[model samples]
Target: MTETTRTEASKLMTEVEGISGAVLPEPAPAEAVTPLEQASPQEAEGIRQRMAELDMTDTTSIVQFGARAQSDLQSISQEMLSGVKNKDVGPAGDSLRQIVTTIRGFSVSELDVRRNRSWWEKLLGRAAPFANFVARFEEVQGQIDKVTDTLLSHEHKLLKDIKSLDLLYDKTLNFYNELGLYIAAGEEKLREIDATQIPAMEQAVADAPEADKVLHAQALRDLRAARDDLERRVHDLKLTRQVTMQSLPSIRLVQENDKSLVTKINSTLVNTVPLWETQLAQAVTIQRSREAAGAVREANDLTNELLKANAKNLREANAEIRTEMERGVFDIEAVKSANADLIATIEDSLRIADEGKRKRADAEKDLVELEGKLRHTLAAANSSKQAGGAV
Candidate 1:
């Protein structure tokens, strides 16, 4: 039978048991059981050929491998279940591996399918419950494998994110710190202008010869406007600080979470999975007697329960990763966009202030020319008045 067919049959058997409240049939005879012997040369060669045909990187290979194992088991099960009711032990024994000496003493009649259960057999029960646990645990194990592979695939990218974000935050933080110093220095300059320069200019406007009053007033206006532009730049710097403060926390939070996740993954790989493997070894130990089988079943059941509980950590880790990814904390575009806008505004403000200074210089030159022309006209008028008086 195919692996899929076997799996379906297993499920159907379970459903039947549920309806009829009848226990599953006894496990196939030792001859029917496929022991964990080293693969024969032919079987190993076949496995190698099949694996060589597959892409190792493709996750579907995992399923294919499980199916291959199941198919082998199904073939063995068919051989044991076929015509066993009427056949003698001799024929059945002939079909088994040479290691069939273990049960050679038992007669065909003694090995009947409907034999009465011994006291120990009744007490130990079958391995169905343990099998169920193993089946469910296998599913969980597959999930962990996929999750671990995914986490590893993105490991480098996540590290890159942490580095980029850290560098960006540090650079911006330094800039803001320097800006704080600049704002302080600018405030001091403004205070000096208020204390000394502005008052002196105001007095100059007040005490200026009447002809120069308009020129003095214009100079003072230009100085005050330049100071106001400095204040505006300081205000914009404060806003930039606010933006950096607000955005930085989220980036830091992501970085911390990522670090924590790395630690958890390492722990799971180094400690958790290895421990599970050790427990699995104990659970799958080969045994023949009813008591030994019972012990193995209990061990497998406990291991499965422990694994089911531990699987939650993997689920939680994946969920946390998705949350941070959805938040886009590692994406620098938004932060870069905001910084670019602020830089452009600062550049524009500086440009406008420079234009204002050029206008002020031109106004000063025009005032100087007007004053020279006024002096020349007054000299010419005074000479005309003296000449007229002499006449």
Candidate 2:
């Protein structure tokens, strides 16, 4: 039985003991788990919630509220700018100036992944057997790299588009708000001219001596023209406010769409990209594993063949030795001399064979090294050709 099965059985026994009013010993503390393993589910849930909020799904009610507020602001700016100079209006004008600066300086934050080592890079290493497999891995890896580059480029473009939208919305809101304050300030100046300056100019025109009368009349005319300009400004401000207010709903709609897109992109980065990497790694591992198995079979076959060849060589050597012994049996003295010579020859043959084995091993090593280099060069050339073709 598995450890888990046994643990469950023991737990069941403990539970039964507890239920039967028998005292059960307390269990030891569990092993500590890594933070990521413990909190991954919680983190995913948090991402989902945050992404949903950013998506602003079914947020029509809030959008309608914003639309209503924009409408109310339009009416308020129009009504408030009729004719009034107040101390409070001064602060509003200053605030409008600050808002203008703020909107002009606005910037958006961008998200990016840090470039790190890939899993395949650590696996391929400098092994002769794996060289071919590494080449294949690199080929697939090149495609993966292209995909990564494309995805990042797309993400950058998407962020740029969102930034543009944000800039437009901010500019629109600030322009209308500042325009309203400017209209209010203009109306206040117009009130001062009408209520105070105009009457004073008229009185001066009536009571001035003959020589000064012309000058007073000129002053009154200038005041009247200034008042007319202020009245026109009030009309223009009203029209601008109405037009801008109409655009508010549309801008908000676009913002909602952009926000949804950004949220999805973020969600994909968190969930989809990692899954892709995991599956891709698994695929590469399986490929390498299969290649390793094939290599093992090839090596076994080669070893068997080498053993059979070695056996044949041993049989030939033994037959030659038996022939030499049979010839030495013809004369006693000749046989002694022949045996001595044969011993020397056998020793010499053993030394030659040992030298030949060492030389063969060296040649094999060199050949293997050359083959590895050739394979890598060909792989690189093929990759380059493929890239050129793509271009």
Candidate 3:
């Protein structure tokens, strides 16, 4: 492990020890306690024994462990995304809209009894309004039933998603814990190599005879190589642990979304639907009361109009009768006009008689004068005849 990683790990161990009240082993010292080159054969033998005790040369299993954790994280991510995608609440919203539209389409006007129905229709209880109203109610109920079924189906799916998320959360935590254990073990192995094995092997290489030095040096080289491989494995474990840390919150967020959607679905099923149905029932009752009240108001208005019209006609008739009862049979103005017309006709007849008498007197005088003239002419003719005979 890197120095920073080791420091963090040490801090974590301290915190864990404090919480649990358990004593852990102290870390190895930075430098070796004794020089291996100047040591006796028994001391060198002890060094070799310690090296054997801390051997961790084979790292294939450790590497595979980290690779498995990484693979599991990828799988968890894919599953989490799929669950969230499948739990969509859009269909629930669509159902709510349908319910609202169905409710709005219901009309109280349909329940009003017709004013112009024939007498027989009313007597036989054959008014068409109530029938239409009942049909409207049935239609609304059918629509509500369909929307309710849709909402129920959506709620079921959301519930399933919530249960699945619970399992995913637990799996993510397990991976997190396993990575931590693997990293901690790798760190311990690395510490042992640095603190004890590498130092002892170096001393052994320096103190060996000229003929055996090459073998000791090769042994030291092999030990160092193992330490490098162990560090690489610990680094991989730390990387996998980071992935698990990020996944923990991501899973919880998706789970929370699912839970919120479920709560909304429950509210729609338990509260809103029941309240809307109750309100629709109340609307029908209120509409009937309104129709009854309207009929009474219309009757009162017609009675008032008739009373006013009769009173006006009676006032006019009484005025005409009173005027006739107080009047004379023959009005004085008519008698006076007739007498004046009769006198004017008599005066015109007297004037015509006077004009006729004067014309007759003038005609008599002219006839007497003409008779005298004829007698004188007869005497003169007799004389003329006598004179002629004497001659």
TM-score of every candidate relative to the true structure = 0.33, 0.34, 0.51
Global CA lDDT computed for model 1:
0.52
lDDT of 1 by residue, 1-391 (tens): 1234334334433333332342222221111111113445654444345435333233343223223323443453354346233423233223222212312322433323334657776688844434544554465455545444443333333444445545555554444444444444445455666899889999999999999999999989877876666566546645655664565566567566545444444444445544664554454442124436667888999999999988988899999998887886556888899899999999999999999999999999999999999999999999999999999
In candidate 3, where is summed lDDT lowest over 10 consecutive residues? 24-33
Q: Estimate candidate 2's alpha-carbon lDDT, on a 0 to 1 scale.
A: 0.52
For model 3, residues 1-391, the per-residue Cα lDDT tens digits are: 1234334334433333332342222222212223344445765554444333334555554345345545665686687677667646677777778787888876655566654656886799874776666677777766766676666667667666666766766666766655554555456557778999899999998999999999999989887887887788778667756765776777667656656655665566556776777787786677677767888988999999999999999999999999999888987888888888888878888888887788888878887887888888998999999999999
Position 223, candidate 1: lDDT: 74
Whichever of 1 and 2 has more TM-score, that candidate is 2
Name the lDDT of candidate 3.
0.66
lDDT tens digits by residue: candidate 2, 1-391: 1234334334433333333342222222212211222435754443233223211123342122123324545454444334222313234234334423432332211001112335664476533434544554455445444443443334344444444544555556655554454444445455666898889889999999999999889878866865675567556765766676566666656445544544443334344445655655775576567667777988999999999999999999999998898875377988889999999999999999999999999999999999999999999999999999998
Shift of residue 9 alpha carbon in model 3, Å: 52
Q: Candidate 2, 251: how far from true, in Å?
A: 3.4
| Top-TM-score structure, candidate number | 3
Q: How far off is residue 349 in model 1, in Å?
A: 99
Q: Which pairs clash inside model 2?
A: none
Error of 1 at 340 (Å): 99
The per-model lDDT (C-alpha) reads 0.52, 0.52, 0.66
